[model samples]
Target: MTSDKAHNLWHQTCAEQIAAPVLSGDVTVDLVVIGGGYTGCSAALHAAQLGASVCLLEADEIGHGGSGRNVGLANAGLWLPPAEIRKHLGDGPGDRLVNLLSDAPRLVFDLIARHGIACEAVQNGTLHCAHSPSGLKDLQVRHTQLKTSGAPVMLLDADEAAARTGSAAFHGALFDPRAGTIQPLGYVRGLARAAMQAQALVHQHSPVLRLSHGAGMWQVETSAGSVRAKSLIQATNAYHRNLSSTAPEYVPVHYFQCATDPLPEELRATILPEGEGCWDTGLIMTSFRMDQMGRLIIGAMGDLDHLASSIHRAWVRRKLIELYPELQDVPLRQGWHGRIAMTSDHIPKITAIGPNAYAAHGYSGRGIGPGTVFGKGMAEALLSGNDISLPMPAIEAHHERMTGARQMFFETGATLTHLIKARF
Candidate 1:
């Protein structure tokens, strides 16, 4: 059972649980990883599998941050369309990233099958639903671009989309056979379990107090213990704390989700019958999916702790009725929120903090596939002394300006949008 402090549905429903004692003494290893989210756990697992002695430290429980609180869509690519990605990063690098992430869902599912992770793994597919006519046009372009890049994607018109989603609200949808969903917290915890089986030391409630490097070794100090290693990986993302100098810089946007009680079998038979995850094309995006027990999960961009949280909640209630009038009386069973490390260009980044230490962040809300792939790539690069396996070259530093302003802009915009847009 999950601790009472774990207020999210994922924690309560997660089938995988790992018990890691807090650090109490000094330890030495080839690599020391900070943070217990997907990237950190994946890095630890891959590094250990490569025969590197590894130590992973987490400030809280595994998947305590965004990894635990996300919408559970193990999507295939970034939020930006292919052309926009190419525009931000030129053709060569853009195409490379696109191709790498195009097959990311396969990598994720294969790992689940190989490790026997029981995280409600489903490989059916995902839908990019169109919220408006303009949104349909956008999906049309995305379908063309994805197909041009060899993705087996199908564009569905209004009738087809309505039939698949069990709602007449969407004008269309783009179906990608490569994408899927999972119980995210369970998946991350499963990775940690696998890493432990490979002889990696994992410590929970071990926050790094200070870090220093000299003579080709990193000295990481925590409250109760310390770690010395030749390399380090910081995978904290938006939940980073206590390490300001080396922490990633990005606009911290919040995303909140609400889940309903399991619907009757008849209702479940009609809604998302094929078990595909879904999200719509809107500036303030919304996501929808069903858990293994038939609970309908819906999410949007906004902070649930803000004063405007009531407005967001009200909007969700009304939005549910708008999408499915039959669900008008269904009360939300759980609601929670997490932060996203968003970049101006909506791309992930790997920054070289020091000689052999790297900090990766800025997934812009596309965490699962990219995080796992980047973590494995980082482990390979660090252990082999070659970075050719990395999807993108690591940079010296990455900076984001007006991050506070941008974060507020997103929250305020989401609040205003939710306040007025979903009314009957």
Candidate 2:
């Protein structure tokens, strides 16, 4: 999660600090945004730039949620393949969303450069390594669909993938040169700072206790103050509090990461030297990347603070050793976990809750890119009163059943996998 603790690595080196105060006294604005993750910040930035009076409120510091804790791969598209997206959505909307997300990395990187965000932006690309032959087959299907849609993705054989990844543990890889990684927390904070600079008011430590719509304005009440605005956006995603019973619901998934201390000289040259981040095609995915300081950051799905913590940690140690025996002694000293909002279709949702009020959630694991893009779309749609301009049509409701049981089931499966893998 975007953390309450300043001990997080991204926070330590962050370029932007939270300078906004809590919502003080009553204020009126054109737009009021809740949850200071990617979407909220982006929306605030865009709306303010468009000359709208905007105020953004956060429960904690900006990006102190999944936006700060994500793997930071500015990937293209949703977890579902393009064909599957068409099956879920009709052709026009599906194709539009696919095309928009295809350029998500471009948008994210552009913002970084445009804003001079101090986050380490590595655009060398990412590798989807095949975990097995079946995984390779899945890549093949994905590759065909991507190629058919004019994407410049390339598939690498075992030898090529191994040479690039420095790990001979996969059948092949699908390489997307368009995508890359970032220090997520820093990036999100930078966005908030930029939004503030553009005249958007931001408040931290301003959790909204109650939200109501009445008298031609949406009102959010906080301990410090209340905000009344013509438009409101709920960008909380997975870290959502019970702000409204009518808010969209999604399955909450947990992902955790541990980073080794900066590698010694000899080891730094051996792993991911090409600067490409990677994730495998397993049932439970694993991601590996090198930070600007050469710390080998690896992550998997499971909360590090929960009952499965030990099993997950042990498995991480063994998995690192299995991937690269050269750094067996290096310690993974830092561990953190964050939540994900997962929709049933693995696609993001734009919900129209009431007049001039909207909520977006469920990017699954692809939040950075989608969240940024979705926020921009939300701003444009709300400001212009044009729902048809959105990438995906805004629906009245988005429903996901049994989120709690589903979350438990996913955690249990991850725990069992880690235990068996560590022992075997």
- Scored by TM-score, the top model is 1
Residue pairs with colliding backbones in model 2 are 2-64, 2-65
Cα lDDT tens digits, model 1, 1-424, are: 1113355889779999889999999999999999999999999999999999999999999898899889989988898888888888889888988989898899889889989898999988999999999999999999999989898999999999998999999999999989999999999999999999999999999999999999999999999999999999999999998999998999999998888999999999989999999999999999999999999999899988898899988898988888888898888878888899999999999999997888899999999999999999898999988987777779999999999999899999999999999897
Question: Which residue pairs come into collision in candidate 1?
Answer: none
**Cα-lDDT of candidate 2:** 0.88
Those runs of model 2 whose alpha carbons end farther than 4 Å from true positions after fitting are: 1-7, 422-424
Return the TM-score for each candidate structure.
Answer: 0.98, 0.97
How accurate locally is residue 327 in candidate 1, as Cα lDDT from 0 to 100? Answer: 95
Tens-digit per-residue lDDT, 174-193, candidate 2: 99999998999888998999
